[model samples]
Target: MTVTESAQKPEAPANEEQPVVYKSNLEDFEREADVRLPFLLSYREVKLLGIAGVGFFLDAYDLFIINPVATMLQYRLYGGNELPANLEGFVKAGANIGSVIGQFAFGYSADYFGRKAVYGKELMLIIFATIGSICDPTGAISPSGSLIWLGVWRIILGIGIGGDYPMSASVATDRANLRRRGTLLSYIFANQGWGSFVGSLATIIVLLCYKHTMEVDGHTSKVDGVWRILVGLSLIPAFGTLYQRLTLPESTRYAEAQKAAQRVQDEESIEQLKKKANADPGVSEKTKHSSDEEGSGTQTPTVETATAESQSVKAAKELAHAKKGHFKEFFAYFSEWRHLKVLLGTCVCWFLLDIAFYGVNLNQNVVLQQMGFDGSEGTPWNRLFKIGIGNLIITALGFVPGYYATILTIEKLGRKWIQIQGFLMAALFLGILAGKFYTLNTPSFIVCFAFLQFFFNFGANTTTYCYPAEVFPTRFRASAHGMSAACGKAGAIISALAFNSLTKSIGTPAVLWIFVGCCIFGAAFTLLLPEVRDRDPDVVYEQELRERERARH
Candidate 1:
């Protein structure tokens, strides 16, 4: 028997009379197949998940590389002086603005077209944009000119990053087995943590190696090379997976559904021809006469006539369904209370999560410095190792393990409950940081930062990404995630633009307190969402859509 055939074999019920409701169609299979949670992926599922996961790591690496590189740029380009504040804010917000545009455009495209078309194009955009930004004319170009040029390139880069939100999530969702989808999907997003960890480690190693030439002007001129190297490293993963992506098969279930739709259309057309034949006097009379010639034959339409009429009816029903499926599908997701509520709860939680999450990450350097992660006032080598190696340690000890744990236990703890706990914990930690900022010394500060990072990964960071992709229906999943991620990115942009200034003006305590509030709100909002750990994404979504459609009548 085939794998699917094996999967289809059902267990006998304790009570023999209880009937099994085996799935009759691809939609049923699509939903039921996605929930596989135990362990081990099919070879095809693993390949797709790996490609999608790698995309996430690149996204994380690119986003985090700027953290250390920004300091280097200030020293090299601005002559290690206090540069204008507006320029600093502009630099931080450039990519974020681009991300918003990318999410909406590509998210809708994935739904309208297909996931495969949009999947790898983002990586190409990123590779080219990064190259452009690295080679931007530096010497003769005015600051404004460079700003405009860099900003434009960053926006392009943002588009690629934004596109990944829908493309990666949708691809993973499409390929995943239903039972363990949350676990499998979680593994893909876990790369972001690893990416951050690797970026930090790499930045430090590069700085240590190149420390000999480092100068502390407003910008570190020598560090530009390191930034270029950092930007270029992401290309490796992008290119490595490009081949697999080229050969990757579209989701079998999706293909089957499309084929079924096509077959229904073909059958309908043949039926229409039969109906026309049966309606003609000549054909009808001939069919009747032939039927009568068969001894004792009852007066009935000929087999061809009957087949054609049946086909035509089936075809008409299918066409009508196709037409009604379009507008009704979209309207059902929003017009209904249950679905609208789920969507709202998810979007709002994401909005709140991002406010805290991005605010902290955007200002991690400040926290690092506050915790005395700034290398000794002496050698660039020593400072680089301390910050870089510290980040590597966190990735190894904290992020990697935390993510793997989530993946292993998502079935047990459940996505909703886990997320609730994570948000609450994040809130609690932020509260601690806020309460302790002034009173805590270096070690205590480091401890707090570590704790916050732990929960951020273990809780909100990982689950926020996973849940949005899962909760929304397949048809709207990409758009919902795109909107949520875009909203989150917007929060990040706001944090990036305002974080430093806010920390400077109001102090770290106050800034952290704000994050605490957002986290608390996120935690509270998690209660509003359903515990969907057991549900298959596509099935749950389609069923919900169908129910909503029925209610409208």
Candidate 2:
């Protein structure tokens, strides 16, 4: 039934204990949940965050590691010639395409089946796909075939990585206390930086160990081991977190919603029974005496029996509703414009931020060259080592620190203000880089790139993830988060697919100009979103409920 139709049912008789009891219980749960949960992070909260963070860490590692690994594959598969331009973009963007599908599917599933039921299954998919990526055939297939094989596995891996966005965001936001909700989510998301760093660092370490052997061979055969090892190492963390995700209890808020839905069903059932009795006076008199005798024997038993009957009716209704499908309910719930606008703000802001963010990130090799890490001065093995070191250094200077800054001040700065400022500041740096593309010295370029990285994380990137998790009601929170994240990945896919070709056609200066525009538009879109600092979603939902009731009257 539509929410309005359900809400319009006749009020239960004043003497009915079932409706009163359920209302009181639900109110008490909300009061305690809002006031007590947000103030502290206990062991349980830490465990939840850690379990969720692992998926994000793996997501970043699997996605970003492709850059360096693809570089290695070019050497091994194509005799150090540059990978074909079409294949290069396809390989880089494959995971993002898979992630878009995964986000939508898993986001809706999490809401439909309950978070705990679907939480860790994505990790299992990642583990399997990561292993498959490592096993990509070399001699068995032509060069293009090999690249195609790896790309297909990356897409599968991307599906798992994509699922993590909504699953982890919903889990973290649901468990976090109102005061530290932003801080907790930042901690989970900060893992993306660490994942990127570790992916680079791992490649560097493996390359150093194999540098001599690969140099002596004079062919790219041994370099094949490097890509396999780098891809396979991700399996370690995914395996470690699997059991915990599978075992996590459903969020308290979700549990409460299940109870509330049940209460509504019970209220409706009792109303139906009262009408039935009124229509048959003879049966009503007989039933009335029976109830009185039962009540006289024990008032408590009579009340308990009525409450039990209400609960059973609720269960039956819930089952019937379940059979009708969640997608219908999802659209019905979000059909209102006010609710739809919040989803739009989250999706658009993320879309704009990612187009610039991933465009820079996935194509870091271009920026690294500007910083003098282009590997021109050394052998092929040494070039790989320098690239790895360059990635690690840039991540240390810009990426990791930016995420921590957001964690430290997200609550104080508020999501909307920080996102706005981050986008505007990032745009400023992009303009500087574009305007000085040819003239800027290596040190100056590095400084500008560092500032851009800092603001992207400290601003829209973190806030975009946190906002969807906080703004939507629990029933649709996961789906909304997934949709927003999918929009962001769509931006990432566009960057991955188009960055190389765009640079070839327009020159690097023009491309940077486009990114600067994306940042400016991202800032403009930030105006549409609400500030969620210290705000509880449950309280927001209650206020919305009251507003709807007033409109109906």
Candidate 3:
């Protein structure tokens, strides 16, 4: 009998408790609630998010480390050789291009497979690449050839950093509960601040300690070990978190999806059996015939009990199947998938925001010099140390506190509003800095620089990373984030490669204007996204789907 018929059939006595029969279609019921995973998660959730957060730390370290290292390379690696402006651009752009590739490749692959399969593998790839690049020798190489090697390995490193974006973002999204998801995700992302701060600190320590003994640019120097030490430092976080990630559970949503898919298959088989029994009387009659050869005959206790037992198993399996869909199963999320628009929009915003954010950040060194921070004029060691300290100070004053503040308040404020306001703030500051760069002296310039960095973190940087993982459905959440993050990395590449040349040719003020423009565009684009704070991930899709259905009708 169908569920409707079963539900309508009868009721038991008041004193006797009855089984709660779920008479709804499996699809309809499954849509309503996914079962919690078999294992306990509250404690494990914290551990898993921590593992992912560490990935962001390494990612931040590797990315910002380039700034200090670039200065060191300009003096040390190229042999105080004047690096042609064009070659300098290529060297910088290499890693960002690689990041774009890694993000897209790993991200799509993770979505196609399981999140657990892709999680820690990227970090290992980074470790090996870092080791290989460090081992590169300059003995037989021309300046161009050496740069090619540097760019190649940087690309390799970029891939690993790129992969971290989706893996970490999606993991946090998958593990967090609805009530505090934004808060948790922001915490995971805030590791970038520490990464930036530490990168600067590492550069400072290496430069200061090595300052007196070395020779470069016709002077005594302190930056001989700078390249090797800075690059090697990234390995610490990679090794520290690898083992912990291996032990973490695949997300409960993933587990539930897998279980749900299995149940559906089982229910279909049972339904098929019932159909065959009805179709061929000879096959079914062997058991049911005992109840009635004629209409007048009644079901015996033995026969009724057997039929009831079989029906009970079938119902239980259906219930189980409806509750947890398969994690690996690819539900056609765009066509048959109801929440495709939101996913598409979220991904696009990440791409747009990244192009602007990275373009500005990647070329910040040029801005530093334009603002009169030319380390080339001072004692080489003293110059590098000053620049490194500046990086550390800006990171501490701007990124660290802004990120922690976001983590504390995201739940109360909401993700959409925060992102919208963040983009606007970043745009506003960039505009101010662009207009003032020519007019401001050192003190005012420093203040504006600090303000721009602060507002960028306090506003857009925190939200762009947080929103993607929050918006997508569990099945494709990582993949979607990967795509968006990859788009952002593409922006990073544009910034890295072109920022120097753009500044050299067009001037620093124009470059700042470009960033300001990107920020403005980002702010305008963000207005389209739905507000998602304090909302459940599972139900968000359903709510979006319903809105579409209502529109259609």
Error of 1 at 97 (Å): 2.0
Candidate 1 C-alpha error for residue 2, in Å: 19
Question: Once superposed on the true structure, which residue ranges of model 1 sit more than 4 Å away at CA?
Answer: 1-42, 212-220, 255-328, 379-386, 393-397, 541-553
What are the Cα lDDT values of the candidates?
A: 0.69, 0.81, 0.67
**Ranking, TM-score, top scorer first:** 2, 1, 3
Across 29-137, the per-residue lDDT of candidate 1 in tens digits comes to 4554556545556554566567788867977787777666655555556764544677656666777788889888888777655566666787788778888878767
Tens-digit lDDT track of model 2 for 1-553: 1000001122455764222111222333345555653434555556766788998898888777888888888788888888988787777888999999999989988888888789999999899888888888887899999889888988898899899999988877766656677888988999999998999899889998897788777655788998889989998888888888888776666655554444444555566767888999986897799878987867567667767777668655674565345566578667978778888989999999999999999888899899999665677798888998899888888899999889888877898999999999999999999999899999999888999899989988888899999888776789999999999999998887888888999999899899999999989988888888877665566456546546644
TM-scores for every predicted model: 0.80, 0.86, 0.77
Count clashes in each candidate, considering only residues at least 3 apart in sequence or on different chains: 30, 2, 12
Which of candidates 1 and 2 reaches a greater lDDT?
2
What C-alpha root-mean-square deviation, in Å, does candidate 1 show against the real structure?
7.3
Alpha carbon deviation, residue 543, candidate 3 (Å): 7.0
In model 3, which runs have C-alpha deviations exceeding 4 angstroms? 1-46, 215-224, 261-331, 336-338, 542-553
Task: Return the number of clashes found in candidate 2.
Answer: 2
Report the lDDT tens digits of candidate 3 across residue range 1-553. Answer: 1011111112433643232122212333233323532122344445655688887888778778876776676675565556766666666776677778888888776665566777788888889888976765654677577667777888888888888888877766765555556776777888888888888888877776675565344443235366777889888888988876655555655544444345446655666766788898886785366435544334546556656787658645643554344333335455543356566566666766766667766666655665565565666676777777667767877778878767766777777777777777777777877887778787777777777777677777888888778776665677778777876776666666667667789987788788777777777767766777755554554444445446644
Worst 10 contiguous positions by lDDT, candidate 2: 1-10
Please give the distance, in angstroms, between residue 357's alpha carbon in candidate 3 and its true position after superposition: 2.0
